[model samples]
Target: MSRATRRGGTGRSLRTTFSIARPHLRGHGLLIAGGMATLLVEVVLRVLEPWPIKVVVDAVSVSLGADSGATAGLPAATVPLLLACGVLLLGLVGLRAIAQYCSTIAFALVGSRVATALRARVFAHLQSLGLGYHSHAKAGDTVQRVIGDIGRLQEVAVTAGLPLVGNIVTLVVLSVVMLVLDPLLAVVVLLAAGAYLLLSRRGAPRITAAARSTRRSEGDLANTAAETLGAIRVVQAYGLEGQRAEAFDRGNARALSQGVKSRRLAAALERSTDVIVGLALAVVLVAGGWRVIDGAMTPGDLVIFTMYLKIALRPLKDLAKYTGRIARATASGERVAELLEERVDIADRPGTPPLGPVSGDIRFDAVTVDDGHGRRLFDELTLDIAAGETVCLLGPSGAGKSTLAGLLTRTSDPFSGAVRIDGVDVRDATVSSVRGSVTVVLQESVLFAASVRDNIRAGRPDASDADVERAARRALAHDFVTALPRGYDTVLGGRGDTLSGGQRQRIAIARALLRDAPIVVLDEATTGLDPAARAAVAASIAELTRGRTTLSVTHDATSVRDADRIVWLEDGRIVEDGTPRSLLADPGSRVAAWFRESLQEAS
Candidate 1:
């Protein structure tokens, strides 16, 4: 069987579930232990609680009847005895309440801590996963697993675990007590509980299936909503709101249907348990009454026997109720476990050393790579760029210009060959070290929802305010940034949507400049800008590229003319490599034709 099949199937066993939570439990061992201890004390007190009522009943019966040998040495006035029983009953209940409170608080604290730790771990893991894993994964589905599924596990810790364990302990203690007091009545109670367990097991598979379906449907609904909202601008511009709503409604309806089926099964189990418990109680009552009338047992003895029977069977009812919760938690746990099992394909090799500062010499050594779909993009391709040299990669779309940059940044690895920086193979260096030496400014400027200063400082978190301003000034973004409402402190909306495209690009340039890395990648950075914006960004690029080994991927004639050399790629090979002016001056050259077509499109 496949790994996923084994993990998604048998990996959800009770032992596996606890293993997932074990670290957090161990971290807060004292609190969890205290909670269990408190629960155990509460259970013992509950077992003793009914005895006070039995004492009162026996005392009253002795007072009303002729004074028998059993009461010969007892107090003549039963009021004092009744009062003492009442006080003892009050003390037991009050103490039990305090224990319950402590246990609840302790368990809740442990649950919250576990949930917080798990969320952080899952989030960090997701961030560490390779781009290839994320490309095929849905954002909404991932969010559901991280948030909704983990949240369910938290509930299992507090609600399902403690209660189930506590109830089982209570039931066991009560059963032993009942058996000692009256074995025949205890046998009937045990038989009823056994039947309830059988019925619950019979219904478990269906309930589990329905719950899994419901969780999956909810994930789908979350995905649909997130996708639509993330692209709300496109959806609204294209009038797709009604369509998105219809899709969401379909998923929501399916979730509702599955949830109802799960709840119905759970409810049926609970009602069946109630009926079984009630019949057991009636049987014990009828038998004990006959024993009382025949002088075989006292009325108080009958009362205590019935009370213990109720206590023993109460957990059976709870077991039926908690079955649905456990099933839901199991489904959620499976999803979480699957995500956690995802391997980090692009991580640094074990014992890999950190790379030192680079002198900016880069080489691709007989590299071969495919586009992850068996389509070869490079085959034994070799290239070299010297220190401080600016090379422009010219190509038609899908000619693998961006793929080259991805290799340099360690975003993805070559199929069979090595990418080297400063004569050191990237695969032999720590991933962070390799990436830290390069800065990239993509076609679309990516920014978080934060102040402009923070966005620029993201390139170097330790950069001072003065350093940030200096970088922005170099990118020609200082003037506009100062004019904003809060200047450098102005908060941008998601993706920095409040800024114009050129403004965003300038900020991106400022960010790259602040990194001060030895190597830079400008991937179609000026492709979609207006004339004024392009000029501003181009000037910033010219400043940033100076003294740095830069790779410019573009079809723009201006960016090409500014490059020291142009490498024109066609069919996974370099068809032309020379000064841009030399290539453009050749009339019969494909590079010249490509440049002419690009200039014509721009005009």
Candidate 2:
């Protein structure tokens, strides 16, 4: 709205978006060239189209006792001349129609293919963006940019852009032909075009502003809908249906008003073009009539000038119609471009190798992490875990317990120092490689609505069906999975909500076991389960973590009672480190005192 109303600024966004999508437009050069060739054929046909009409009008004037016009050799009958002219007109019109169809089809194909490829590329890029970007991004707004905004570009290209190109060429060719026929009449075409441009310069900014506001409102509408639906259960529990409906109404009304305003602005511009061209046509009619009477211009030549003027003016109508559509599409295109520009937060450095196999030796060497708020979670704190050992981390919230696990998987890089798997720094290897060598079972286990076997095999895509069942048996999940209506093939609900807490956890454990990484992390995995379910899941955790470097982050005394080492953290440093028995043996121990405080809070 600010500068887009200016002559150059209006087109900059459109150019940038197409430039971003240029890579996907490759491999279709032949079709694009073919379309241009076809359009050239149509323009040539249009130039000749008015000639046949001029012949008919002159032939009629001669028959009505007018001046004897040049009736070429031995067409003694007027009927034959008229019939020939009519057939010629039909032939030109028919051929032009065919060219139009082929050209439209060719451009349509390019638009569709480019849109598809760009959509896929943008979607993959979104997934590659860092957790930092996604934490603050709204899922609904992101979806709007990926799907809705991209679709608008394709629609405008086929419906408006293709026709605009052909019309522009027609306008130019016809204008040149008019000048050769009668230079003075041709001035009307130039004058009409200049007037349309003037109106456009004045009106375009209002249209752009309205379209931009509409797109933003729609994004907000989508966000509100997604947020409400995702939390439908909570909304229903709190009896907030009226409040949610009111929010949706507000967004809907805002979008409608802006969309209407854009349409109104565009309509006014188009109608104003009609007035400008109409006045130009009146001037030509009066002036050309006098020239023809004085014999300076033939009646046939005047007819050609009038026909060419109408043809040249047609582009003004096209410009008016397509301008509004293009502005809206430009706004959407800029939204998608902005998302594609997000930096990839985690990636492999140059010349780095993939993380192959490694022993379970882990080290946090002088590691420091800033939470982006000036406060450091870990400032040069170092820790080490020997191969095939179990370490449980206990801390009150915000003590950097989970941050350690995040570092190992390369979910984020340490601010200052390094986290090494064996001897290789995690940052030096490919991100996929670092994450693939470790397995994690988080508190909120996320699963798709797929078969039990599919969910289990997600850990290792190449794992066989037999291997999946074996991992499930070890995790104590096979019995219940087989009891479902369709056994392992039974589809679950969204987020696997159809399963009980214990059942969902066991399936997650099976997936981790199937991964079979050298290091495993369980972060508050059993926090929200009933006592009986917790005990059952606890047993599955044992088998999954066996013979691996295990990290269990929890405050539940029962979950970590068997750990070989317990590290209690406070204020970004390890406050207590010992075996469970050794730490509990001391009554004044931080770990023991924390347990007492937890029991009192529970009571």
Candidate 3:
């Protein structure tokens, strides 16, 4: 592989991202105008600084050697002219200062807004992307691109982009004024500029590369931190805090080192520019002094030439600084674009119809699922559930019950064959439709940091307070919820840690009940509950499953006993299919043996 390709930075050309950002550039109109005004004011003030020298020189020359009446050649308004020039120069300088201040404010305001808008757009796009895209990516890395990297791009918009234009105009205008004074001196300044541009161009890519490396490492660091924090419980339990901390420190150190390298390159480029400018000034001074001694150029013209040279070189210094900032911004922008370009693996197909409403019937036809590892989760399994039927899935650990449940709700897609709800293939239905028609209550209930009522009502946003209370009561969660300090309005903290495991699970059941979907999959929903809570939850499940297609993956005999049909699975295949009564009665059956083992384990 090419070196760039090996670096994982070769897929998209940088220019394409810039092209996409062209529309956003329009946001800087006011900033650009303000910058132009500032440059013009600065050049006009610089151009006037040499006028006082000319006035003093002429005034001295006339007093020393001119004929007494040569006052006719000089304006009788000499004192007035000198005073007026001073006033004008002061006025120009003041205008320059004001314009400079306005430019800074304008550019900063517009640039920050543009950066924020761009980031929002990128984030919105990322959300639309497929799960397959996010699976191999890190959450922290994605957040870094959206937040940190996009923020860096603001410097380019404010400093490099606008100022580059403003400086170029200033340089051209000043160079012309200098040429009108002394062409030879103007040539010297242009030569310095040429050298500076050449050096800056050669250095741009190296600096950009270093900046890109720094940004990428920072993203990796963010990913490490987020990953560690996300699984803090696991990390603590496994005594992995030191190992994770070391990993994060290493990532942070790498980023810091790369940042140092980028800064060093930028500093070198600036120093080179300063050296070249200093050399050019020396050359101009020597040449101008010779011309003055030879009487070829007046001292006033020499003074003007020097002023123009200084003004011309000032922008070059500005450009050097802006160049480095631009490189960093480009690097940041490219990283953000990389994330925004990702596509989601699972999404509603184009032209797919809404599921509208579904009956409880479910069909799995020769369905097979691959776990993205080479292992098959299930192989060509076929099953049918009549409307409002309650079924139990009995499986050994790693027997693919959770995978099957995920497939039912379109959390994933089958590798071959299909899963249908009410005879409609899930893939052919809109995601909203499928999700609305089928809901799953996971083994571990997730509760947001909200009031108890809000948590239960989230499953159906339109649900009223009365409806939420009804659902909670049916789930057997109302009594405890009402006992909380604030009852239904009580806020749950830290994923509802204030409640016991059984309480959280009961709240989840309330949420599922509120959803009112035609099909429900309860996967180990009662696993962590105590005996009393487990029995109460099972009763609620029985009540809720009265008129829905229910698929329960469980080890609880009470839950299994309530199933109309029991499907026993082993090694990703259905090993037995029969009514629960028959399966439990068969002594030789794996389902019966597993049931007995679970009962023994529970006891």
Candidate 4:
């Protein structure tokens, strides 16, 4: 299928555009209505704008006429008549400017509000999509849709929709007035407009396709830049700057080519409109001038007819110019719509009760989980941990340790069977409630660019300063945080890059500690730390696990030694389960042998 076909084509795209924009527009109905009202006033002023010029032309003609008797019957002299017309011209111009200003401001306000609301909604929807979707999705592409595409919708509202509507309205009103003034001239104008419309319609599909391509190219370019920049450290370490630059250049070139094609098409359409309009004006001038020479029309009447025709057809000229903008916006809207339409696979079932405070008893009942391919990571796996139990999950990589933790957090559901906390099926409880009962620190600690205190308080937004300090102390991060230039208020760099590896881990621990969830998970929290840092983090881990039901996934024998029970897995089945001391004392045990090997490797 063609790219356009895959994206539902231009017609469907326009429909999707309206569907996404309708709610935002409706939300600010009062603002939209006020904008339209101003537009109406502006159109009215535009229609009346030509009358003062017509008056000036008539007065000038009479003043220079051979018949001085024409002024004898007039209420005022020709000089005063000319002066009055000039003043009226100024008034009309001033009033029209004011009306246009109001209309533009009103429409801009509505457009900005719509953009802000849609951006927020898109961001929230992305967050709600859960880990599974995000894991497989590109962060750069998602960011492009949320930020870039939504931004285009704002431009369409103000730069395309408002102007298009206002121009169409002005054309309609002026067309009526043209018919009243001269039927023959009006027909000429209508025929020219119809021809322009037909020509524009013929080119619409091409323009739409080119615009879609351009938008897609821009998204690819953005994705390329985001990915390369995000992996800059890796790129520099591997000396892959040249390769990355070449990739970005290719994407940039494609975007530029597409953009040029779209603009070229738009320019062609605009030039065609100008030629057609010029022809129509020439026909009007020739026909009206002949009538004037034949004594069938006045000069002032001819002037009015031509002025009105130009005013009526002005929007058609603008319409041709804005066609590409509208098509580009349609393309962007389709991308945004696709994101908003994504199904939230992980969400609370209807009427599911909130999981209250738990005693932290966790169980996996006859659980079977697949790796999303053909491999079954867990088959009828059943395990139980008592309240406040510190269980260490010991296994080689790919033995489904992290998957098990994912199941507990409801990050991914089991293929068949149930995961429960305190005897309540996780699926039967609200996702928020389940998450509220568990706190996890991943192998790689993730931190945002924020003040140290705010980062900790993210675990519990209601945490007071003292509460934050208490959690930091428990995680052994309080002393260092206070030693910083701004103490707890010191802002960290992106991903907390300003802090040491061990410091970041401790801050993460503090965050989890602040949550004070009954169940805690440490996924190899001490894997990469040096001896001293590891010792410090291990101490913090001890403090964090003191009263909580802790599940630690680790290869560190030190961590395993402190566990109340050790569960060993091989090929997704539990090979052994026992107290660490009992298991280590058994020389023939596979778990003991694995631990011994891990310790020797460390040495």
Candidate 5:
């Protein structure tokens, strides 16, 4: 990953990137072929363009009595001959222009189609990645790869990738023609090209290294911005704006430095190529001059040699410029490939069937779970909840309360054992079907920027608007929703931040109600609300869990009062399990002690 220690590294990265792009390039082969065909046509016309000028020069030399020696097959220098040369030159230019235009458009279309396909594929893959992966990923950096990096690929495909491909082909053809014209002069042209290639090869690693560094710094800057903006409330509350700005500036400065270095290196390479080309032109002119003086070659032949060298110089110089472009684009491609190639750990086992209708018998069968840091959460622990039972889990922070809920939901799989609905193990069934049978309301309800009705219906997409309204009314959200500017049709702000904490909770509970799943999970669903809001959300939760098998994970001692059973957990094992009344009946019990603490805090 450093700037040095390997040349093969760049080559390997490019090969991997192209392999990733291969699937996206399918079905566009014919269009690409047609584009290359046009490129070949343009090359042929360019080589022929100098021929008419050669004929005119040879005839003029013969007429002036300067090259009766070498102008052996010269055309007569007359009015008709000069007119024909002019017409032929104009025709060749016009045809080459048409070919160039066609090739450009064709490649542009393929670039657009392929980039679009890749963006969509990368986005979908990110969505399907396991929660474990997302937990550690920075959303802003991921967004840049999906949007900014892929966009560069599409742009370079037209401006750099396509042009470079054509120029390379043109270089090869022109070199062949020069050799055919005169092998001795062709050596000078070919040697110039080889030197340029060697110079670029020597400089490529530095360019690639700089490009990769720039991309990484930019991604870090994006991550910094996203993190700062997302926590703006905390920042303002703590008056840490200066600190955040300082962090942002550091990342921004690094990105600017790397970016400038990359551009500077590329510019230096191009200017160096200019000197090489000038030397080659000088050498060819001197050598061609001697041949003409000795009558070994005609003046027109020397003109053709110099003209072809100039023509070939364009691609040679352009090669240096476009190589820098390819390096930057390849850095972006490496990032994209890394994302697309992430391992999917939480997907369903192949051939697993979808879940059948469930009566809500939940079981954790001797489960051994890890917290991803080698810490054991549940070691050989077994628990079961019968149909329509309400089981509440009480635990301190990091005691695996929410982690327990995650297990049933399959957010992350257990190290061993099975989580089952009825007799069906969750992992033995399709992930979508297993999750569809359960509804969870989290501590902070996440809502999208969509109409109130649409957000609630995300629970069950087939739910009618009337069903949405009924669910909202049940959750005590209907009144506020109706008071909005457009009632249920009103759109919410990002994460439903437009609403109060209580209002958001009600809407989330309404969504859970609309789902009407057989299994329900309430993960501290009423923790942050005021007393009044808590009461209202509690009533809504009561209705949602009326006939379902409910598992409420909580730190609030008061909320466990309504459960049929209370299980107290600590350090990944259950310390106490019994009916709430029995646990309260014992003054020394953890539940009783917790209830006392809650009452003291309230007072």
Candidate 6:
């Protein structure tokens, strides 16, 4: 399996996601304050700009009227009022412009900070998860959650969150302005807003659902591509290129179809909102005109009311524009929440004392393990190896030899018994110390896309270059490694494709040697090597495992005969355990038959 990337969920609601994201933004106090201030200023400007229109209308009406009083006609008194209105309108517009600029900058800063912190936190949490959790999850799905999902949320929080507050405030301010100008027309606009809200409530759920499906399909597509690329060799070996491509195409088509559905709902919502706004304007115009003719309302009042009605619909329009982001954010937040809530299977025990260095002696007592599938892996299995003895386990392909090796290193804890190292139960010791004392080198050696020297040093990061070269020499990899164009510094592509399988395994052995652990486990170490290569690797293992407690699982007769003792496992049971000479001398022994078959298969 590839390393952990990130984990998140896909959800279908907006309010839940925003509430979940609140904690991430709680630290950005200055940004929140600035954005709120800008929103307030923008609303104030929306209300003030229309008063000037009212002023111009009143000034024109009075100037052309037949009235004679100072308050009724265009007298010298009207000049100061018109001039003050003009100046106030210009000043508010300038303030609104500055506030809008500040708001944008503040939101961008806050969004970046929040997204960075969340991604880092998620990455760190993933590191704490156990091997079992990682084994079942995909690297691609996790990567999307950490980078793409969180990034989509940043856009949502900035575009949807701040504007949500601003638009609602603008609507309220416009309502108050209209009510003060003419209450009857304000009632008409209010009714129209109620209708808009009702329609939004009716359609919002469907749009949100469609958006969530699209997001999930996109994530599935990402996982499919990642899995196919990682297993490109296997895919090509089986001639499955077309099959993988078809799977990806299916996922992509599903996402596109769902996205189209969401877009259609959003478009319909917008058209309906526009229709309501236009109808409200017509009603208000007719009512206000009648009141003006009856001398109950001024012509200035009618113009101001019309502007207020338009301003009130601004929130609904903002809602329309942000609908898609709100839906996507809801999905991303739910995904993140699900990942954060997962319990880590492997974690530190409470009040457990730290374990220091360990001796090489190993023992398994009543070591019964189940594969979690209601089948026994090993039943009542018990064994022991002295501090410096090398033991080889020989068995057929289905004999649970590899499973027994895994139990020794605590890669998995046995179900019903104890795995002890130097007389201490591995469960009683700290996880890192237990792992540090034992290392396993498997058949498929993993090499990162880094320089050969760095890949070797992964076993012991603090190892010097000289120590690394010495370890490589001991593993029989030094000569071949030096032959490369860049030698030790040569960068290897994924899984070290530039090198042969035997070379990769040798590097892995060198890495294990650098670790200098007292207990070493090798699983089918040279199973895939040629006869000459196997001889070289077997000799290297013998030299490196000197004076260490080594448990080697092999079907190779050469490795078996080289061991101090050979334990024959059959159906997860130890059928025979003795020195190699004694086991091989008995022709009827299962260990002898298994070794003969392995040698024949190699030939």
State TM-scores per candidate.
0.95, 0.94, 0.85, 0.94, 0.96, 0.88
- What is candidate 4's TM-score against the reference? 0.94
Better of 2 and 6 by lDDT: 2
Model 6, global lDDT: 0.80
Q: Residue by residue across 238-317, what tens digits does model 1's lDDT show? A: 99999999999999999999999999998999899999999999999999888767665666778888888888787988
User: Which lDDT tens digits does candidate 5 get at residues 315-342?
Assistant: 8888788867877887888888878778
Question: How many clashing pairs in candidate 6?
Answer: 3
Taken over the whole model, the C-alpha lDDT of each candidate is: 0.86, 0.87, 0.79, 0.86, 0.88, 0.80
Q: In candidate 2, what are the lDDT values of residues 1-603, reduced to their tens digit?
A: 223223234568678667767998789999999999999999999899998878877667666655643433212328788889889999999999999999999999999999999999999999888777888888898999899989999999999999899889999999889888888988888999999999998887678768878988999999999999988989999999999999999999999999999999999999999999899999999999988887667677788888888888988998998889988988887778778777787887899999778888999999998776788998888889988999999988999899877888877888888999988899888888888889999988888889999999999999999999999999999999999999989999988989999999999999999999999998999998988989889999999988999988987877667898999988888889999998988899999888778788767
Model 4 Cα lDDT, one tens digit per residue, 280-391: 9999999988876665566667898888888888888999989889888987887888788877978888889999879999999989988878899889999999999999
Residue 140 of model 5 has an lDDT of 82
* Lowest lDDT 10-residue stretch of candidate 3: 2-11
lDDT, residue 440, model 1 = 96
Model 5, runs deviating above 4 Å: 1-8
The alpha-carbon root-mean-square deviation between model 4 and the true structure, to one decimal in Å, is 2.7
Model 3: runs farther than 4 Å from truth?
1-20, 23-79, 97-109, 176-181, 234-239, 294-300, 482-491, 536-544, 555-558, 570-572
Model 5, residue 58: distance off in Å is: 2.9
Error of 1 at 174 (Å): 1.0
**Any idea how many clashes model 2 has?**
0
Where does candidate 2 have its weakest 10-residue lDDT segment? Answer: 68-77
Give candidate 4 regions above 4 Å deviation.
Answer: 1-9, 63-77, 586-589
The superposed Cα distance between candidate 4 and the true structure at residue 73, in angstroms, equals 11
